[model samples]
Target: MPKPSSTKKVKTIPVPKSIRIDLTGHQYGRLTVLGFAGYRESAPMWKCQCDCGTVADYYRCNLRSGTSTQCVQCRHADLGVRSTTHGQWGSPEYRAWEKVRQSDNVCKRWQSYENFRKDVGPKPSKDHQLSRKVTTSAWKPSNVHWVHRDNVVQQKSNSHLIRFRGRTQTLTAWAREVDLSPAALRSRLESGWTVREALTTEALH
Candidate 1:
């Protein structure tokens, strides 16, 4: 039998372990990281609580990249959509809310979709719009309602401009803003009444 040739022995080097990032008690937008959740696809995830008190898990990349700032409800609230409770993200109501949610006319309380939905209720029909009784007034429960587009009042031109509450608009616009009657507002403007006076004066209603 032929003698076997001697072979050299090879040694393997140990790889260094990855350092895990500790994110406990870190706040990102409306979320506060509670602890490490687990790993997903070899990536780390974290458990977080939203400002609204909802808890959920998110990937570290999403939080660090600013992609997952808030929990589902709060995020959807900011987007004028619902989580699993209502309709889809791009629904008509979502589109309508998108147009006005950023405006100063929207009440700060409405920032929470829960409050908005509770006060305004659901959209009656696709033809309806979110409207305020006083066109220029901020959106609130008492003044807000769903009105059909066709039946809504036609806005007049900005011919007669009046400045109120650090903002300027036409008489028609001001009429919808404050509770003051249009006739009274026009009289006030024509009589050289200050915006504060017009907004603070007793209502004719």
Candidate 2:
């Protein structure tokens, strides 16, 4: 008699449970939900009409969490009006101020563009950005300064930089210094390789 052949059992993946929330005809801030737009990244999306008479698709979570309200046109309109009133609209200074304000990271006093200008004065160049001297602290006149974009980028990149071989540098910087691609170095790190091994390993052609 022929010996019985072994059969391998396959595991079935369970279907993900969907949590549905109906938001049709509901008003959230300046947005009125019209109907479902479809799914995005596995999350439900809704079609909404803004008070400005524009229709856009928004994530259901953003609508319910109050993250997004009006359309982009309305936001730009408000920024333009407020910035023009301060005589700094369309200027680099105004753009920097608007960036901070939109993030809701500004101090109450800075809410007024005039007050913000009075404190920060003006941007030295188009490449200058508003930066907080103490990042952990709130955005206040005394804690903020205008810094060159390059310096800001360096500071941010350096914050989470790694050190190897008694030399400290960002992953990109180290990769460039060693003639290795940054993406490859990152991939090695992600694959549980030690930092020293990741940086020193030769790329396979």
Candidate 3:
């Protein structure tokens, strides 16, 4: 009988240890790292305390990336404020208000639902959105109005409007009229092209 072939044993590689960083006493946004919670799925976790007096576990990466902030109570409170402000949390009016507040950098004055409702009044319709009469103005009662969503878009579009050949239209509208992509036209404008050139330029296929 032929001699049995010698079998070569395969060597197993040991798993590399993860680099651990101590985040104790480090503040990330509203959270202060207290200690290491342990590991989950081969990643380190941390125990953190929020300024609002809540303690929770957060992924190590989330703290370092500024992604985790505030406790559950604060997050719920914020969502409640937004939802109660416009009769419902997921309403179109509330979402519109949120978008306007973020875009215009409106200060938060209406902490209570009553204050927000008293100032903004009731939502007229599902199709209506909170709008600012003056684009540069804040979301206060004096500056805000309930307008159709299309009207809001038109109003925002008017801000960057171009006037050429006795015609006034937004860059997007001009691009549509001239058979150019709105995104390409905007890019050209951003690159310092004149409105005429941006609107007139043919889009490359």
Candidate 4:
């Protein structure tokens, strides 16, 4: 029979009997190793504080050397009530909205124009000229106009605009449904017709 090979035993450093930590020049006695966080692939390993007032300072190699330490625990109690709002802007849906909102010139111009008018009054002024710079490829000067609050709401109630069927419809179809010509509907919409009046007159016809 072959002779049994001798196995070398690895020695481990034992936790100290007690630990002391100085916080703001005052000595804290019961500080224990809580958790650890640092670059795993580099030097300057960190020590975690425990409940027993012990601190475990080991090298990154030492941490990998054994599995004694761990990262912080996820506290469920701390999470409290869940929020009903949307996720952060970095999420997929938010990112998609953000991409169009930021990059698409047509959408950007519409938003900017509306905001500008709301904030600093109607455009077409020397300063407001900048706001009019935005337009869709098909946008025309005659097709754009300021509308009153009531007229705006009236035009929005059309089935075409509201989408009664599975498919989405256009403003032109809504206008046609109410017996108003496309030019008339566009005129009213651009002039700020309300959804209520727009839908009523269109539907009545």
Candidate 5:
């Protein structure tokens, strides 16, 4: 019988000091030898083992020479997928967003929304925790009038609450009590009137 040939030891390449392996998705640190085909010194690519048991190319220049230690799949797991759609432009949810985008009065706010979509991504919901009143449902064309933030304070102050006070009073009725026409009160508030001016009964007269 022929004697068994002695097995040659395979050379293990040293991982670079700067190299960082994305191990979030991987359960083990050891690389699967099957996926990474034996070293090809001539080519610029190497087959890398994936946690999913799939083989992928890990550029030698990227792995040993640079910072890449794992396949593209591992990299994607670290960074969430980025969306290409604008916040309101392509969304089917905000159907009336197109009209606001074209209107002159609302164009400024719409432009801001568009810019935000370009930078981050679509967010149909309000994210500012400081202001609890802002909501996606309230950010409509008619509701969102272009006035200074201070004017928003003025409107909030003058706004009538017609709870069950014997009989609910219409805004026109409340204006009558304050001795001012509904149109006049609305104009004062819309024109960025001071909070004190909106609250005082003298403005009504």
Candidate 6:
């Protein structure tokens, strides 16, 4: 009763009417969104539990975009593997395997160096390198080879590199996936069509 007599009704600020996407219970790589962590500036943040059991806050966009897949400790741990030379961890041969591996060109059956070597054979010399026969096609015995670095063909100036679903490919490769003309897709992209719209919408002509 005493408080009610003295206190006056003051205007209160309302929470901003922003589009909030609830990512609770969603897992993005090693980080799983546990709950909200308020806002960083105007952007929302999420409280995530890493695979290593570290709980921390990260930006919503980063988690949603697949940019931040793991905690810092886990990333550092990964470098430990990269620091080795047993598998020639950072060597060109390893990189060649990694490149195709990440792009889903090679399957899990070819994961180990032994299997890769069995299929790919030993490198003839230091100058020899692995090359993909078809940029878009999956990597297999018939689709890959070893060639001298100097003998590699230079890509053309007009060749465009576009990324889709975490894999970067030449515009020509993407064209194979679309039923419409590659020119039409290129035109759509050039005309500011979103990736989804350009890839999905069929042309009348």
The lDDT leader among the candidates is 2
Tens digit of lDDT per residue, candidate 5, span 26-128? 3223233322322322222344454444455543333432334444555444322222333243353232343333222232444454443343333334421
Model 3 scores a C-alpha lDDT of 0.60
- lDDT per residue (tens digit) for residues 59-162 in model 2: 66566646567777887777776666656777777777766664323578977878888899878887778886754345788888888888986665555366
TM-score, every prediction: 0.37, 0.54, 0.39, 0.21, 0.23, 0.42
For residues 124-160, write the lDDT of model 4, one tens digit per residue: 3222122121222212233244434454444444422
- Residue 57 lDDT in candidate 6: 77
**Model 5 steric clash pairs:** none
Writing each residue's lDDT as its tens digit, candidate 6 over 1-205 gives 0112222222222333453457777889988777666653334567777777766777665665465677777865774575463556655666666555543236456666546667887677898777666544456777778878776545321445666778776665776786666666655543334455456654443
- Which rank order by lDDT, best down to worst? 2, 1, 3, 6, 5, 4
Show where candidate 2 strays beyond 4 Å.
Answer: 1-26, 34-47, 57-67, 159-205
lDDT of 3 by residue, 68-129 (tens): 66666776676776565345676555555545433323546743444666688778988787
Error of model 5, residue 95, in angstroms: 17
lDDT of 6 at 173: 70
RMSD (Å) per prediction: 20.9, 16.3, 17.1, 26.9, 24.8, 13.1
Residue pairs with backbone overlap in model 1:
134-176, 135-176, 136-176, 136-177, 137-177
lDDT of 6: 0.59
Give all candidates' CA lDDT scores: 0.61, 0.65, 0.60, 0.33, 0.38, 0.59
Report residue 67 deviation for candidate 3 (angstroms): 13
